[model samples]
Target chain A: MKKFLWYFSVTLLAIIFMFPFVWMLLTALKEPGTALVLSLPKKLTLYNFKKVLFEFGFSRFFLNSLIVALSSATVSTLFASLAAFAFAKKSFFMKEYLFWLFIASMMVPGLLYVIPQFLIVYKLGWINTYWGMIVPHLANVFGLFLITQFMRQVPDSLLESARIDGASEFKIWWRIMVPLAFPIVATVFLLNFQFHWSNFLWQLIVAQSEEMYTVPVGLAMFKSAHEEAYTLEMAASSVSIVPISLLFIFAQRYFIEGITQGAVKG
Target chain B: MKKGVRDNINAYSFILPFAFIYMVFLFLPFIYSIYLSFNQVTDFSDVFGGLSFVGLKNYLFLFRDKEFWWALVVTLYYALIIIPLNIVVSLLLAILLRKRYRLNSMYRTFFFLPFVLDAFVVGIVWTFIYAGRYGLLVNILKPLIGGIYETGFLGNAKTVMPSVALAMTLKGAGFGMILYIAALDGIPKEVYEAAELDGATGLKKLWYITLPLIQPVTTFMVIIGIIGALSAFAEFYAMTGGGPIVYKWGTPLGMTKVTGLYLFNHFSNLRLGLAAATSFVLLVLALGLSITYSKIQRKR
Candidate 1:
């Protein structure tokens, strides 16, 4: 009986939480008129999906978001790990001060930097270019911080032994730290990818060319194009979510782990 | 001195990428924005040389602007309403799910689903749900619930901000829930077991033990929540176009507009200096709140 009630409440909460996604799915499948109303689809069809995917150049936007997200994720992770190794393993005069400054930057709201970042990009003549979108994000503070914490856990003796054998710090970082830090690397990649993919404001600002727009910008434009085309819009929304949802489902354990790692300590 | 300097050079080499990119892209831009904010320039084509000093007029004028104040109020109101509600709801959900049951992971994923979703997608999806005339509520729940059929929740001046707030709450609650769950997991089981032996159960144990122990995480979440609310632009842009009826909402748009959107608007309008000024103000506000929060957290 206790177990039964537990299951019942869990199910109810799950429904409350998952209702919007389900509603989106149902809306995507229903006819336009039916979607506007609260009724369930009498019969599901692929028409809305076909319209959004084939007719609307959503495929190009998806590819753009994917390319930008992946490029930024990969490059940022590498840069963060390299910097984190120095902070973790090296002893220098200004190490503490530099690390603190890096961490301080993380506390600032991202939007705070968006304007300056835009101006900088414009000055460099990198606006609407992939480099403008990807470069600023490549030196992520949170990623560096996460990796630094993780690196600090690895015993100094291992690195010392490699050093004694005439291996450079860079070699030790490349060979030993990178391999051992796989879990965190994956964690950082997934988290960063998710954030970059979902980021809209910067994309909307920098991506002036239609060909350069990410999925979110494209979807926003699509929605505005046909305010009354509710089913098609919902279908576009669903399509946009599918990739990120799948990515999250696969790596949720690590994603949640990475988030909590810092939350608890602070 | 030579050997020590060599080590410094090596260490700096490792950190070179961070310093170079962050300096060029972030720090330099930040400084430039401050410079831009103090200037007035009419033409974008002459950005570097054309700017003339404007003093505190931009800020003084900002204080007098009604739209700016409204945006500030609405932003704060959304933060005040949603942050506490989110913290409370997430804590309750975390505690409720503390006991082991089947499909707990599924429940966790369900809650987290909306957050991973694109904000534009959430905005679009909820727009339909909150539609005035032909929304799902009217067609399905209106007859039974009986009063929601007449109003467009997102279109109304009174309801637009709150309606958007609730959507943000729903999309955001899962993240808070995840953080709470992590804190809950870290609490030693024996602490709860001890509380149970003292005849304390349910909300009593939660009130006495759980709340105080999780205060750090709660504080962190609240700080982040306020910053998130203050900086909110994407959802407002996607859902409300920054206005239902143009009453201030306490968002960053009050002084600067969304730097991103402002830049887009003025990219062709030749008003780069004004846009840059707006950006600088937003950055300062964000940094000010973050510094205050950090100090408070440290003192605690």
Candidate 2:
């Protein structure tokens, strides 16, 4: 009886957590007029999704988000690993001070950088461009810290052996350190990807043109502009969530590991 | 000696890419923001042109700005509510799911699922759930609880902040749960076994053994939660737009406008100087909390 009660409560909690997403999907599938009603749709249809994708030009936004997130994550991770390798295995002047400087920067509220970064991006004539969206965010201090923490645990003997083999520093990082630190590297990449994918404020500020709008920006605009279009809003929200949700489900281990590792150790 | 020099050269080469970007984008902008805070930029479009120095004017203006104080209060209230609520919910979930069960992993996945979502998307879905007439909550409760929820949770001044905080708490609890689960896993089994042997069972065991063991995680969560609450923006932007405007002392304040949103509002209005000042205030608050956290960690 006790075990049954436990299962029951857990299941109830699960239902509570899952309800909003379920409702969103259901409303998206419903006809426009029926979206507000809670009952099952009388005739489920793909009308809302189709409209959002084509008529609202969400496909373009979706593509923009993908390109931005992918490039940002890849470049951010690559640079972070290079710096992490230096911080972890190599001896450099002021290495400790530099690493601490990076760590301290993380504590400063991100809002402080917004006005200045925007001006800098504008000065570079990157407004309404992917460069504006991606460049400012590439120097990810948190990613650097995370990768540095992981790479520090990497055995130094392996690097010494690679050095003895006359491997160049770049080749050593690419061939040895990367493969060995692949899990954490992948974790940093995935975290960065997720961050850029849903990053709204920066994208909103930079992507002034409709074509450059990412998923979150487009959805926010869509919701506000079409306030009465409940079905369409639901569809757009669904589009914004589905890709990340699918990715999370498939690679949940990395997501969980990355989050916990960062919090616990840092 | 030459090898040492060569090693230093290689290290600097490796660090140069990130350091260059960091210097130009992050470090430089950070310094520039301070400079911007002291000067009034005449044009939003051309921040570099027509800049007039107005030392401490922005900061002084914010000192008397009731709207800014209200945002700080809302942010503090949000932090107070969300930190405790999230810790309780997440700690409970972690404790409950700690023991191996038939569907434990599935239950964990279900709870953690929401954390993976964008706050904007979650906020939008929640707005519908809290919609006035035909919202799921209203429709479900109208017959039982009656018209109180008619304006919906996000539609009222009294309830709007807590309502948004609740949505955020649900979205965030999974993260805390993950942390707690890891912390709980680290607690040696012998401690629990010894407690059981001493006739401490059930809640007694939990209060005495489990709670103390997870205090570090609690502290971590509290600090992180406080920082997260202070910097909260996307949810307010998406759900309320810091709305259901309430008037106090003849001033209109957004009921949900925390410091992050307040900063964004200033920036949007092209009040660049004020925005930078607001950010500095937020930075001090965040840094203070982080310092307190580190102090606590060191004490242990």
Highest TM-score scorer: 2
- Per DockQ, the best of the predicted structures is 2
Q: Write one digit per residue (lDDT tens) for candidate 1, span A2-106.
A: 889888887887787778888889989997677755678999998998887778877778888999999999988898898989898888888998888778777
Q: Kindly report which residue stretches of model 1 are placed more than 4 angstroms away from their true locations once superposed.
A: A31-34, B143-148, B196-198, B246-300
Q: Each model's interface RMSD (Å)?
A: 2.1, 1.0
Complex DockQ per candidate = 0.66, 0.82
Q: Tell me the spans in candidate 2 whose CA falls farther than 4 Å from its real position.
A: B144-149, B293-300
**Tens-digit lDDT track of model 2 for A138-191:** 998988988888888889898889889999889989998889889989999999
lDDT of 2 by residue, B1-300 (tens): 998898899899999889999999999989999998898878655788868899999999999999888988988988888899999999988988987879898899889989978998899999988778767777777876555467887887877877887888788789999999999999999998998889897999889889888888888888888788888989989899888888886988888888888899899998888889888888888879877876977687
Measured against the true structure, the TM-scores of the candidates, in listed sequence, are 0.91, 0.97
lDDT of 1 by residue, B1-300 (tens): 998999889988988998788887767766776777677775557566677888876666656765555556566677777788888778877877787786788888888778878777788888788876687655666665344567667665666767777888788888888898888888998998998998997889878998889887887887787677766777777777755544234433422233333434544465555656555565577667767876887787
